[model samples]
Target chain A: NAGVTQTPKFRILKIGQSMTLQCAQDMNHNYMYWYRQDPGMGLKLIYYSVGAGITDKGEVPNGYNVSRSTTEDFPLRLELAAPSQTSVYFCASSYLATFTDTQYFGPGTRLTVL
Target chain B: GQQVMQIPQYQHVQEGEDFTTYCNSSTTLSNIQWYKQRPGGHPVFLIQLVKSGEVKKQKRLTFQFGEAKKNSSLHITATQTTDVGTYFCAGPIKGSGNTGKLIFGQGTTLQVKP
Candidate 1:
């Protein structure tokens, strides 16, 4: 069912470059999230959207922006790529108000900034 | 912002041995979810524990939620080679309808030696 799908499985960017990471899900979930995982570190929330047109910043939202124009798609934009921003990004989605349904995560995109 | 802490950042267990990981959240959570990520792979939903002192089991994996709703644990009865990976515990942050925002622990990396 392609629970959660992300684009650009891997990417290499130069300093100051900008790119968008695309995430989509077919589960018709109302909650979507963006997270990044670094070497030996736990996943850090970047942003989240409860529903279409509603977005909020999470733990580490700096240097990134997110938009939820449609319930099926939530894209993450990196304004300025830097070495510190190099990490694997993941997208996840879950049903609203259903505490029992666990989140489904995407395959993740590996980004390397030089 | 709430903080989630997981103990024993890294663990190596021989095959057929038992394994356990503990998680604690700074604030009370409505529910706690567990996820597993294999090397070079994405995180997959394992299980969710809700209600004080709740416990759930999936084969040899057992999950527990503390009575205070601020801590949880995952125990594997007998480790196997297939159990090698990083395990993460996540709890939703406090404040109005925070079910969509999750704070993940640092995660415990489990390596099973066969």
Candidate 2:
């Protein structure tokens, strides 16, 4: 199982540019999430999906969007990249919402917006 | 939004020394999980604590959940160079409109000098 995979391990974008960060999991998880980690900061959730066709905003949803059309994929969209959007982004997925539910993360994509 | 904080932003210890990090939340949590991220890597699940005052051990690492479920701790015994990384504590925030999203702490970075 490839676990979770993310594309574009590294990316550099100019202000106002747009891009889609792709995430996919072979574990067939029911939940998926997108989080950004700034240097020395915690993982700030940008968006998440409970299941196919169900998406919601998280703690830090501004400047980002997400879609969950299948059980194996959850992609994050950066509408207009800004300097503040520069950070390492991670994608994670879990089997279910149980007490023992543990999320599996991807290698993460490093983005730098100038 | 629920917030989690981890102390000792950074900790440096010589090989074979002990190290510990604490995570505190502003509100009660249903469950807490610990993850480790190696330098330039993504977060990986270590363990999850559900019961209050629960403690679990994994080889050289010990994880504990507070009696109130609002805090957690990770202690490493005789740290090694391979233990050098950032440790994070996360939980499914409980409050108005829960999204089953995990709120992560501002991880504690550990530097083990061999």
Candidate 3:
């Protein structure tokens, strides 16, 4: 089964451009998270959703937005991309809110802003 | 904001050598989780530690949580090429009601040389 799927494995955008990174999970997990990873750095949380229609900002939420319209989908939108936003973005989903179950991650989407 | 710190930003070990990475948090955590990301891959859940002074093993890897619940460690008995990757420790911050949000450490990069 495809646990988590992220579309557009790689993309390049010019400064001030906008794009949405798509993420979907088939496990019907209640918790979903968006994170970015810079070279040689740990993953930084950008946003998270506890369930459908319930979203919250995370540690690094600047220059990004997220929407959880359905339990199977949580997409990240970059309104105006900046050079600093260039990084590998990851989408993860967990079975419950306790985080006791493991988070399954997608392959990742590499975005580069110039 | 709560911070998780990981030591030895990078490590190089020869085959058959032992390796360890330490993670410390500024505040107590309900639970701690470990993940490993291979070169050019997304992070994958490895294990989780819950109880104080708890230790768990997966094959040659051993995971430990401090008695205070503010620190953790991952030790690999013998290094191999398959173990070459970045290891990250993550835990939810005590305050701010970040129930499902995890703060990740800077991560420790392990390079196993044959």
Candidate 4:
């Protein structure tokens, strides 16, 4: 099974450009999350969705937007990208709320905003 | 806002040496989880601790949660090159009213020399 799949492994965007980072999971998990990792900084939550059509803001959601149209897909949109948005973005899904529940992650998308 | 902090931002060790990383949270957590991200890779779940004073082991690695549920530790015995990565600790903030949100530590990067 392809656990989680993310498209456009790498990309470079100029300031004010916009793009979407697509993420999908085949595990049929109900909990999905979007996080960004920067050098010397831990993974910061950008957005999360508990189910289709239900999304919530995370710690650093100012420069991003997310939509959960279906249970299998949670895409992150960068509208008017800024240099601060340059980082590695990861998509994760969990089957349950238990702490022991493992979160399967996608290969991640590396975005560089100049 | 809840904050998770990790100590010793970076460590370099010989292949056979031991290494340890500590994580502290400003507030008590409902559960704590650990993850590892290899070079050029996404964060992968390692293990999780729920109960107070809980300890779990995975081969050469040991994980522990403090009695107060506000701290944790990950120790790797006789580290190898395969252990090179950034280790992160995450937990759900208690009383946040949002059970799905996770606060992550800054992470500790490990470098093992041959």
Per-residue C-alpha lDDT of model 3 across residues A29-89, encoded as one tens digit per residue? 9999999999988989899998999998888999999999999999999999999999999
For model 1, what fraction of the real interface contacts is kept? Answer: 0.71
| Candidate 2 chain A worst ten-residue window by lDDT | A94-103
- lDDT (Cα, tens digit) per residue for candidate 4, span A6-108: 9989999999999999999999899999999898889888999888999988888998999999999999999999999999999999887555566788999
TM-score of each: 0.96, 0.96, 0.97, 0.96
Off by over 4 Å in 2: B96-99
Tens-place lDDT per residue, model 2, A17-75, is: 99999999999899898999999998988888989999988888999999999999999
* Runs of candidate 4 exceeding 4 Å displacement: B96-99
- State how far residue B93 of model 4 sits from its true place (Å): 3.1
Could you tell me which 10 consecutive residues in candidate 2 chain B have the lowest summed lDDT? B92-101
Docking quality level of the chain pair in candidate 3: medium
Clashes of each: 0, 0, 0, 0
The TM-score between candidate 4 and the true structure equals 0.96
Categorize the docking of model 1: medium
DockQ of each: 0.70, 0.72, 0.69, 0.66
Q: How far is each candidate from the true structure, as Cα RMSD in Å?
A: 1.3, 1.3, 1.1, 1.3
Quote model 3's iRMS: 1.6
- What's the fnat for candidate 4, on a 0 to 1 scale? 0.65
Worst 10 residues of 4 chain A by lDDT: A94-103
